[model samples]
Target chain A: MKSTLKKAGYSRVQKQMHDVFLQFTSKVVFFIIIMFAFNLFFAGHYTPGGGFVGGLLAASALILLLIAYDRKTLFKMIPIDYRLIITTGLFLSLAVPTLSFLFGTPFLTHQHTYLQLPVLGEIPLHSALLFDLGVFLTVAGTTLLMIALIEGEES
Target chain B: MTTDILVLLPIIIPMFAGLIMLFIGRRPMAHRVGAALTGLLMLIITLWVIIRVYNSGTMVTFIGDWAAPFGISVVIDMAAALLLLSTTIVTFAIVVYSFQSIGMEREKFYYYPLILFMLTGINGAFSTGDIFNMFVFFEVFLIASYVLITLGGTKIQLQEGFKYIVVNIVASNFFVLGIAYLYSVTGTLNFADIYLKLDNYDGNIIIMTIVAVVFLFVFATKAGVVPFYFWLPGSYYAPPMPVIALFGALLTKVGVYAIARTYSLFFIGNSAFTHQMLLFLAILTIIVGAIGALAYTDMKKVIIYNILIAVGIILTGFSIMDQTATVGAMYYLIHDIIIKAALFLLVGFIIYRTGKVDSERLGGLIGQHPLAGWAFFIAALSLAGVPPLSGFYGKLFIVQSAFENNHYIAAIILLLSSLVVLYSLIKIFINVFWGEDMDFSKLKPVKYDKLLVSSIGLVIVSVAFGLGADLLYPLFEMAAEAFHDPASYASYLTEVE
Candidate 1:
């Protein structure tokens, strides 16, 4: 046992340690969750799903990536500042609502219509959808940013 | 509809400015210019809007074509406009002051954006015609303030900011709880609609009073009314000068505004009990706050405690709920916001100059910086409601109304509260500015020109507001009318569906 330990210790091992399963599962799950978030966001226009929940779901997917990898790698992959995301989200939410003011409508007047596309079937389109997108970005951004701040504080 | 859109501008403009600054990113000069311009624009817009409202009636907008009783509504009644006017003036001055005082580090680290965002919340809270919307705006500002209090990330700040956050979170929960209970009882959240629904509410009166009391408790905590004031001094002490000035100037007043609003609007169902309860609390708050001011030799604590005293006096007038008294309260409210912000800036400057907060360590600034010394003295006198300055007329009207209502004790206490205010403030003057001049050669130099300029501007407003009370009286009278007759403010709402 002592000879075997000395043999292992004396050897210069250059192989990198890796969480192969975690990396693979996280990559697969990230896309799946993102797809689900988009679906939820779109479905919010007519059904029970909406931007807030969709945003949270999307954030969780990113959080999963963060857990599997690390903050440095996750941020490198996304290359987006979360504070910018938050402010942009806020701007989007604010701008979308006030779009009515230009058209001589009271603030936040939403409009919707049914439309036919070249390949897709009939679908509903709404200003509220844009609003929901804003909400989605805001919730997602706020959650991730707060987590990042807390993490930075601890370190 | 044009005027209707103006109701949303106060909230929208500051928010848009804040976002634009965020997008601009890290340009200190640009941030300062943007902040100053936004502050100026707010002043202009509020002035214009107030003029329009004065000429016409209240401006009400139903967001997204939502009617007054159902969807989100924005109303710029006489009272809201007046409050907004005062708010803009204070914010503008603070913005200007922040240029020199709020250190470069905090400035680059999103200070202007946070201040503007806080402005957006304040304007929203004042103009929102929905109770639920008011709570949302409260959260909006409170969140900004949380970041602001911890802006520099100092140890004392973190400790105090934590307590501030905890206290506010609990108050917000109570606020939501109160709103929920009120909604459950009234079947509505719009202020006027709730009034309409509760006019003949066959529901239990006990539940209604309980809910009203709950709201009172919540706002009292926000406004730092006596028993609930434990967190105020410590939390306020934690931040930098400009941030503290912002808070002292505006935050507590929002709470005062909320209390005035609820009591005047939906809670009048049992004013005899509810208002009497308010009167008792206001008196108790005054007594406790005056005692606090006396006990503290620390400059900041003395000024912070003065805020509580001002709140008590304002609410004392409001509790009477008469035409004269509401006018008095509104006058005093505006006056207090201005003077308190000025006093805070002045005191903050003193602390910055001396690197000392205890009055015992500060002395005879009058010999060196006579302008600051005299500014503090005048502001101190004005704060005590000395006649020929801004604070006197409000106190006079309050005492007159109290005597008219035969609440003789309240009147007497209010009268004596002024004396206490005078004594406490004068004590600071004597201790800090009256004795031998502190050794200036040993003290580090500070850039006092701009700081003095900004704070003195507010002091001038207080002086003008007092001297030119006649010119402003019509606006205050209109506000008082709005207070007495809710229907005049309500009749503008166009029903939908």
Candidate 2:
């Protein structure tokens, strides 16, 4: 979360206007990206949008933040390590397949179940969703890490 | 279901272990112990699979309970099982060796995990019955190997890694392109299905030849055959000993195995042309490989070129395309896996002791490292096809089959290359292990009993393969049978139908 980036030579653009219009646009983009990613992930199993697209959306949000407020401010707001996120994603993806082994099923065989809830009627849960979430996290983490490494190297 | 589980276990075990290793805490000791245990478990599973497949005939397992041609399937024929077993053995030895030899920093950066991942890809490649799945598995191992080759991040390794990556990327493009051409004609990606459908598509001879040649180029690049082998020597010479040992033992063989599988199963439409091409390229491979070995003074380069020589021998046997030649190729394949790995490790040990890998700078290591020197001598002889060694029997069967088939020129090249192989290796042996001792003031002392033990274990297996050929011939026969008849192999899928 520390601001190791200095306001000097390697910044791609020095045109930070510090205007309210820019601030409002950034906030709107951030919120839209979050909701879009959520919708893409949860609806991935039965719908067109999936973990891969959702994770890419999440990465784009981070890039937007990087541009709006600079990396130092971005890091302060989101204090998560991309590498750790990558590891978690990797574990989640592997765990789903390994879990099938316990049930004496083939690796990566998905089992689905529906639960009748009070508010959300007949919500279907799938093991594949867990795999999708893993893909999402991994893609997001990897893309962000690559950006960070390239950015840091330049500066 | 039980058989399905067994087929799935070999590929899944290492994959799950590899992924788990990535998330584990930053303790190198735990990762090492975990990787070693994973390797041992794989060894046992592969051995069990080999035996089970031998007894039961070819067994096909459809993943996710879907039948063949519609879903991915794992086919465990005797040949595939044997390959899986040999690859697993070499991987286990390399894993154990890496524990002490690879530095802690590299291990911490997902080295063990990458090894397990590499094994997963290799096993998957060998077992999968689908051609596209083969490409998928190839990519898995390709990515892992790219990381492994450049893990140390030295100047030379980086240079070599770039070239290696570029070559593989280009080859992979051809792989996908060739697959597209194949699927367009046959309308299926499954190996058995494609073979069954080959009869229906009789008019596209030119397109089929193009597709087959493209695939042959792809595999030839991978196997480091003559025209495409320039990238292999520098890339292999760049990696560390354990990594190079793994590369020498398993990587190129995967390519050769793929060629054997596809050419036998599906590309029989133009065998006269295709097999002739294989023979011509194989002859070029042998000559270039022998000359490369003779040309190199660096110990590692010599070993690398020797690898190319083994490739030529195996391809020659494969191109002859008979049961005897197939068995000989299998024998030579397994033997080369063991002895080549042993040679690399032994040479690495010598380099560790002498602080240099070039032959001219090293001399009289017999006094200081007699065990390694003798191990090297035996392995070299084995590589050169001396009698009573594993390499000789492989050469014998190959030559016999060639003469029987009236391939006198191939038989001559096979025999002549054996002598050239002998000369090149003996030149290295005398130059490095005999004569006056080199100065040792700059040598760094590291304990090597553990490293030597693993290398010795490999040497023992290589020797056992020679001395126990009587006991192992039946197994080789079973493997050869799998390749000798494509009908029986294709029937594994047709059984349910």
Candidate 3:
């Protein structure tokens, strides 16, 4: 799939776009964003941070990498098709409600309980965590897929 | 217990099936087979529910075991079951028709999943008892439609799709505003609870009237009523035949359904004012649609305009707010969903075979595709309310109620629009099918068996639906009963607690 931008001969006339310092910092920024995104995701059930926000945060980190690197390197590093990611996220989300069907509960019924973890003592566990994970994956996958398509067109 | 809970299946099945289809990578044949099976499964489930609702009366299920009034309620009364049944049938037909007509490349681009999601939304819209939840389902389908309309990526499609989205998004904002107003006034999103609350409220009734009219504006835009219908004809014309059939048969009807649901259930307090206003707009809608249907020589626009006309007639019945008229609206709504789907599929097949949209360019298709020609004839008559066909009983009851209600002008226009419908379709039949077999560049032997089977299948169903109106009368009556006597519906909700 040849891009229109490439076809327009702008690639030859344009200046070399990458800056050395910016590239190194982007990698650092990507890791930090991913870590913070997970924190927000885990805290989402009680706090304001949930799947939708966390997914966007994580997707933005990957988008930074795409901006700094080429499509070839990006795909080589993470080879999963973006569409698959979206499907997986949706399945996970739907699975939670579907499980409720098996449990003889109503649709979208989520059960929560307290769990004793070896390292974490008493912790809250929720079926909605899986549902939120689905939302997170879907948001991240959809954002990145859209950006990837637009990036292909432009660069 | 599980059997009662099957109320959620109509919405759930489609989403689950579509996602699973997406999961299994793209194989065009697999997608077609999978989607066809899913549609069939949904059709069977809907039929069973419709029958059970007919025998047992209205059924309600609350999500997450949340009690009524506080949690989301999924209701399957006679009206909703009827809508679901027809929607599923049409969906099945469209899926089968797309097998032959929609190109493999496009099918590979997740067409089946889009169809499934749209089904999910349509089913959700029909079954939901919560007003806010209805808006959510509307978005689910509208988003799917945004992609379906522009699937081929034609310039016309993109342009039309953009306008279609803009119109709907703005309308949806109004939908939310209407909900907000209703919520503020009633302190409830549940339809049953709102019904109970609005009845007891002593506040200024004027605000409720404004909220009703605001909803009227929102739904009329979606249903393609006059003044707001400018975008409908163009948008409907841009999509491929199957997509067009889906929009023509289902989407606008969702709007019509919203109007009927809201008006009959919650907004009847000031009947004289709100219903009269509804009647006025419905008349104008029918007039504009009748004129537009005749104005177009292009087969697609004619059928598209006919969609608006059907919406008008159904709404007119709803606006009358009488037992007979409400039953007429429900019956007509079901009939229109089926017949319009059949008409669009038939029209689509012609365009596919002849490769021409204009009736002037096409000639003597009956000589080559006699089966399609005959099916279109039956569908046209059915659409025009010729006796014993699908459209007749609905229109007959509507006209009868219009007279009973002393809505003399509405009754007359309702009768006149039937003539326009007949003439417009016969014009297509005579011009396109009855001409001298004119040669065309794309007159190759196209494989049309799958398309024909599916489209003709709907034609068969329409005929059956018409002939079986006697047996179906009880179902239609029960559907109408809920509107007139809300005691059963209200009591059911009260009993839930």
Candidate 4:
């Protein structure tokens, strides 16, 4: 497979130029996506959108990167394992409910409190938001994993 | 509240363990140990919950802080507890059996995690008190099973798995539609709430009956009963042994459990009409399953038919809709889960050692693999409803229920089908175990001790369940009573905290 690919491969200069342009566009898209993802993630606690949507948006950004560049290039750019992200997210999400058990609440029973921070003003903290972050990471990780796998398979 | 918290353990333990196993990556030994430990913990937790539920009656826990009717609730009744226990038992056995049975490559591909996730779904489905929550859990298990089925990415697995997914997706749509219709009409999704609303609704019963039929079709498809059962044998035939064992043991039973739960709780409004339809479906399921079993020469396909027979039997008990009949059904359901797992695992062993699934290429395995042969013999007998085995009691109770209700045709059919079940199983036995002793050298040599022990563990459980039925009868009685009276369960929603 590699020999055939090498034999067919040509015009490295054009490919590099295209990748440079693609990289430029993907970065812009990535920034906008991150902005929207975090916006949705934070706004979710107060409104309609939350971790799932943000996570999905974030995943879409990753998918866009895959489409713009090859999986190998994208992996080199991100340098992060999606599977590990998924496991971390799962543990985080699981920990949210588990924390409640420590406080004699049922699984997934969340509470909100106000905490004064020196750098930031009084912050309203809901344990569920943490759980939502876990959900975000999980959804994002799994979605990216699927895309990465299929991309890897095709390449 | 604590009891409610306890009900969440089965779901959480497996979910957590499965998640943990995901990170264990590529280490087959670690995955096996992690999965086995998880399975054992789940079994212990399930048994504890069962004992607690048996002592205290049904325990209901709402998810988060939301109350029943508004949020998802998990209810651990005698029936649910029994199902949970059976699931954990089979899970533990299969987890152990997978060490020798499942390929190492499959192990590295998150096999253990998928099984645990599936168990989480099964446990949640059984214990959830809400209808929609049941749907969510059903999806959980279905997706997990789908992944497990296609793990090898074999051509057959992929082809059959696609069909399985399509069928389930359609059935799930019907399930959701049914739930939507019921919710729109009754304005509730809680099982108990629906029971109350259904009882109070004085409007036209026709729409409700239609909803019941839709729900029945959905569950019947899941359970692999007649007319809707065409997908089972082919799909189940594709997966590896331990997976097929898990599917044979727990998956279809989850569907049966859903049917029994909904029918007992909400379908009683038009019992005369709805139940007559159910009885006809049940009898048809039996006849079709038996015919399919008799027609199949392949070991896996034949076992798949036995699974259908179990489904038909459980549905028959539900269709009879009497205390005795429900008890019989519950007994059979439990018996079948263990026995079927044993049978599937044994067949998987036979296939692995002999490299043949068809009895035509195999003969006289009892001469060499005495333990497996005997174990298969015992499981086959139990499955066939032979006397003093657990299967016998379930058949007996159903038969007695039929006689009591003067459904002589049903009784006769039940008896004749049991004989057919015996004949079909015996044919496999005679062909594979008794005739034309083959040289042991020609067969692939592998470690059979662990797999044999796991198979025997369940076979012994079946025998003990049978002999100890006198002691276990009260539990079944309580389960039956709980099935008969939804009011007792419904009252929980009205109890002011």
**Strongest candidate by lDDT:** 3
My TM-score estimates for the predictions, one after another, are: 0.95, 0.94, 0.95, 0.95
Q: For residue B340, give model 4's deviation from the true position in Å.
A: 0.6
lDDT of 3 by residue, A1-155 (tens): 99987799865633337777878898899899999999999999898899999999999989888888767777887785887889999999988887887777888899999999999899999999999999999999999988887667532
Candidate 3 per-residue lDDT over residues B392-436, each given as its tens digit: 999999999999889999999999999999999999999888877
lDDT for each residue of candidate 4 in A41-63, tens digit (9 for 90 to 100) = 98887787899999999999988
Candidate 1 similarity to native, TM-score: 0.95
Instruction: Quantify all predictions' global Cα lDDT against the true fold.
Output: 0.88, 0.86, 0.90, 0.87
User: What is the DockQ for all candidates, taken in turn?
Assistant: 0.50, 0.40, 0.50, 0.50
Stretches of model 1 off by over 4 angstroms after superposition: A1-18, A153-155, B494-497
Give the fraction of native contacts in model 3: 0.61
Q: What is the interface RMSD of each candidate, in Å?
A: 2.1, 2.5, 2.4, 2.0
Model 2 per-residue lDDT tens digits across residues B1-497: 42367887888889888877776756788888888899889889998988888787777877766678988888888888888988888888888888778888888878888998999899999999999999999999999999999997889999999999999999999999999999989889989888888845677788888888999999999999989999999999898899999998999999999988888888888889998899889988998998988898898998899899899999998888899999999999989988999998888888776778889877887877788888888998998899899998889999999999998988898899988888887777888889788775656688788789889889988898899987888889888876767777888767778
lDDT per residue (tens digit) for residues B1-497 in model 4: 64256888898989988888877777778888898888888878888987888898888777786877888778888888888898899889998888888987899889999999999999999988999999999999999999999998989999999999999999999999999999889888999988988887888899889999999999999999888999998999999999999998999999999998899889888999988888888888888889988998898988898888788888888888888898999999999999999999888889988988898778888888787788888888888888898899999999999899988998898889888888888888889999888776889878777888888888888888889988988888877776767677776787743
List candidate 3 segments past 4 Å from native.
A1-16, B1-3, B440-442
